[model samples]
Target: MGAAEHRQSPVGVRGAVAARSVAVHIAVLVDEVAFLLRPRDAGWVIDGTVGMGGHAEQLLEGSRDDVRLLGLDVDPAALAQAAERLRPFGDRVTLARANFRDVRTTAARHGIEHAQSVLLDLGVSSWQLEGSGRGFSFQLDESLDMRLDPSLPETAAGLANRLSESDLARILAEYGEERFARRIARAIVRRRPLGTTSELVAVVRSAVPRAAWPRRLHVATRTFQALRMAVNDEPGALRQALPEAAELLAPGGRLGVIAFHSGEDRIVKQTFRSLDPRRFAAVEPSPLTPGDDEVRENPRARSARLRVLERLP
Candidate 1:
């Protein structure tokens, strides 16, 4: 366990106060994920993006004692939180700091030959947005460092400061799906060397027309998303991990993915379909969305879409 894990809330006055002040991240689509994964009596499970071990905890609690879990994550802080959260499970749980793109290799290093179930919950975590000063949230005015793994060479600020206008426009248009990509890129280039989240937010707000500003979404949302994606190479990672995950699944094993955006959903859908039909089958023709009650309680889950596929025996 890391330092953060050791500092997790305990049964004390200060712990109680800290717990009350901090927001708990609710695991999205828990029931749906459990239903799709359907943990076997005695098998290994892999949680590719085990943020705080929410889904992993549920799976372990809901499964037989013989079942084991291999949880992987890019962020060391998240792994620390997960280590503390999953400590009760004892030796049944294994935690590793790694990107999901290297899931197969990481699992192999840990002596996991194959997985009976695999889960990839792709998107930003509440902890990252609320606590980490990584600038994942546009509402918070922090440094423009959006790398999930701090070791990553690129930062959002570096991209904003260095990339040419056309390249930046391409990233916004392709990754963020921003309509005013060129305008925003031009404005960002003109400003050059944006240091903080507030600075970037101001640039975005200024670049877009007042009438064009979205009512529900902040103007800076797209640009931040684009930069984060570029810095992390999220799409590329997903593309590589999908095939590796599919190959790592035991016969009749299931792969469930919860994607929070259109780009991710599209990639999952296309990749699953492109898999050998004789070896794989879609569990559902369409994606499952969070119910109204869940969305009302956890607004962050509103955009979640879950899809599952099974390996043929």
Candidate 2:
């Protein structure tokens, strides 16, 4: 859990490493979140998407001894990792296996009246994409079951194999904003019953012409991202969690959200704008992104955008 876990200057990571480009990356914006939330000034902190407790651990270590944190996540596997990581902090840290959307009720049940800071790092984590063999990444040829929460009924395979061509296209276009959504959806329907990540990847590759493939992104990247979002209902959950976390903030508390892509960023930006400006101030005119060093060290963080919304008295 030393530098290998993570090491940054402003945020807190360790070791020297070469960053490589990948189809998907975990963009936590740890430095910006740690800086803007001002953990030293916080009493109770909440990490709604506390995947592996990276940010939670950083906040606790950076904060005063009295500061406590409540960490929540939909993924049980992630919660297990977090539990082990945060064990050293004892009762100062609380871990819950729950979705960020239910943060309001979950926080209340935990006897937390309000939080001094709340954080939500949207989309899949490094563990899910790389470690978890649940087929989140194209690199893994595992089953197309991308369920963050085990209890979730549906799987990415279900959507890819069951949804109509048009419906599937809509999800790709809207959720992933892929230009070749229609072609991909059509290819998927024709090759229905795609049981594995490799199968789905092949179908996508066949659908998009080699000439039209993105330079940096994999041919199947958008399709997988869209299917995962549809299966998990990410957009819907995000819409609910933003306001809930915002309202759960104390008078001076700030809610920090790190969106990895444009679609998720749009929701975060629009939702922050919809809040009462008099009551909540989005101090950052534009979202803060990972610095050159952070991106150079961890290329996965290149697309991260951190937006802070502070509750006013």
Candidate 3:
């Protein structure tokens, strides 16, 4: 199959555009990721969250055929999709089935010791949002399984049912930045036996006033984000991954992170600030947002924020 064909023919697609987004629609963002890398020299690069191989393939496409890519992903489906997406690069691309938190070890195992650039696009990928049956959206009525990796023990349902109401409220408030976290958590606890995305959505909708719901994007949105974060321990993994990326970079190497939420952006900003100011200079003090045109084309790009930091030689 051609490169374009390979991307669209994934497991399942909800719509024509969504299918295409999984396929070739996102290739353009690859340039943005490569721009952050700015190789400087022909050293290796690591894509810590190489989802669908969108960025990695583009980086390899412009580099010498022998340039290396050490790509990592915790989701098996993502790794599989990336393997196919980057098959054109052959030996130049090395895909790993691992979490971003294990980036340093994964890269080292592939013999990529001094990375020239590292790009991590945190959170769920579009493919996961559309294809993975992990119940990532309130739009879907599937199981309450939000674990990015199904191998994990606790699913979103488990957490929703098991976590103390206070803990659940905190997760929603802190990780999801939801204003009505306490009310949502209390409603969830009261409406026990929550088993699917629809059930969770209903509980949240009922707990939130109609007028208040419209002020925010959607009543169930934050709750979904909160559960996914908890299921994947996304913040904890990111906390470990960013420092690992910093340590793994060669002198003068650059690191870029694409975060989708404030909690993540705060972590990236604070961590970069705490590092050696001279050794690590910010490339974009303010995170880069998608252009209006890009967002118009793909609404998913709306919340994306890209931040870059480069190490001193």
- Highest TM-score scorer: 1
| Candidate 3, 153-195: lDDT as tens digits | 9999999999999999999999888889999999999998889
Question: For candidate 2, which ten residues in a row score worst on lDDT?
Answer: 9-18
> In candidate 2, what are the lDDT values of residues 1-313, reduced to their tens digit?
2211121322322111123322322335665566677455537899999888888887887777888999999888899989998999999999898989899999999999888889998858777998899899998899999898879998999888888999999999998899999999999999989899999999989999999999988888888888888888888999999999999987777888988879999999999999998889875778888767678778778888888887876
**TM-score list, all predictions:** 0.91, 0.90, 0.90
Better of 2 and 3 by TM-score: 2
> Which is the winner by TM-score between candidate 1 and candidate 2?
1
lDDT of 1 by residue, 1-313 (tens): 2211211122242223223321333598876676567464577999999998888988888788988999999999999999999999999999999999999999999988888889999978888988998998899999999999999988999988999999999999999999999999999999988999999999999999999998878888888888999999999999999999999988878888999879989999999999999999887788888766677788889999988887877
Q: What is the C-alpha RMSD of each candidate to the true structure, in Å?
A: 9.0, 6.3, 8.0
Pairs with steric clashes in candidate 2: 6-13, 7-13, 7-14, 8-12, 8-13
Candidates ranked, most accurate by TM-score first = 1, 2, 3
Q: With candidate 1 superimposed using the best TM-score fit, by how many Å does residue 253's alpha carbon deviate from the native?
A: 0.3
> Which scores better on lDDT, 1 or 3?
1
Number of the predicted model whose lDDT against the real structure is largest: 1
Instruction: Say what the RMSD of model 2 is.
Output: 6.3
Kindly report which residue stretches of model 3 are placed more than 4 angstroms away from their true locations once superposed.
1-29, 38-40
lDDT of 3: 0.79
Q: Which residue window of length 10 is worst by lDDT in model 3?
A: 2-11
lDDT at position 252, candidate 2 = 70
